[model samples]
Target: MNDPDRARPETPPGHRGVQYAGRALCWSLAGGMTTAAVDIVLAPGFHAWPVLWPLPWYLTCVSAVAWAVLRAREKAAALRLAADEDLVQGQDWERAA
Candidate 1:
């Protein structure tokens, strides 16, 4: 999974924190606003079980955030690799044989 050769957008060195904050804000606003709207609409139907009304929508938002974080971490791991040691080893093996 930590393949350094993958193509991705290169973020500037010092702005990584800002970029992360922007992403978090976007996801938070989208999930919160959409879920709030849906909960309001469903409130009339599930008046008795108010807790269950927003459960599904909130769970979906959480799952989406989790998925995004998983992908970002995977990409970060790939980017952190200094070099592909295996490629050098493969070249050596080829030369020896």
Candidate 2:
């Protein structure tokens, strides 16, 4: 089996931007759940995330961001030519000089 942790080429920042936005959306959902649970059960003085107040809006935003990221990935994948086309010009990375 191949290791999935092999280094990826530097994708354009647009790809990264979409990915990070999706991550934030996930965090927002998690944080909101924690905050709401705390409010319903914990005492008043405990620290809580700001996620609860947005409620439905946060969920909607997260869903939208996820959809956008999926679309972007599809587009990028469609544009990629092939494995051999994305190679270093001179030599293989694992070979001796």
User: Please, what is the whole-model Cα lDDT of each candidate in the order they appear?
Assistant: 0.58, 0.59
Per-residue C-alpha lDDT of model 2 across residues 1-46, encoded as one tens digit per residue: 2226555456643666666667767777776677667667873553
- Tens-digit per-residue lDDT, 1-97, candidate 1: 3336665445523345445545665666666666677767755564555675555556556656665665676566555543454665577689779
Q: Quote model 1's TM-score.
A: 0.36
Candidate 2 accuracy as lDDT: 0.59
Which run of 10 residues does model 1 get worst, by summed lDDT? 8-17
Model 1 spans with C-alpha error above 4 angstroms: 1-47, 79-82, 85-97
Ten contiguous residues with the weakest lDDT in model 2: 81-90
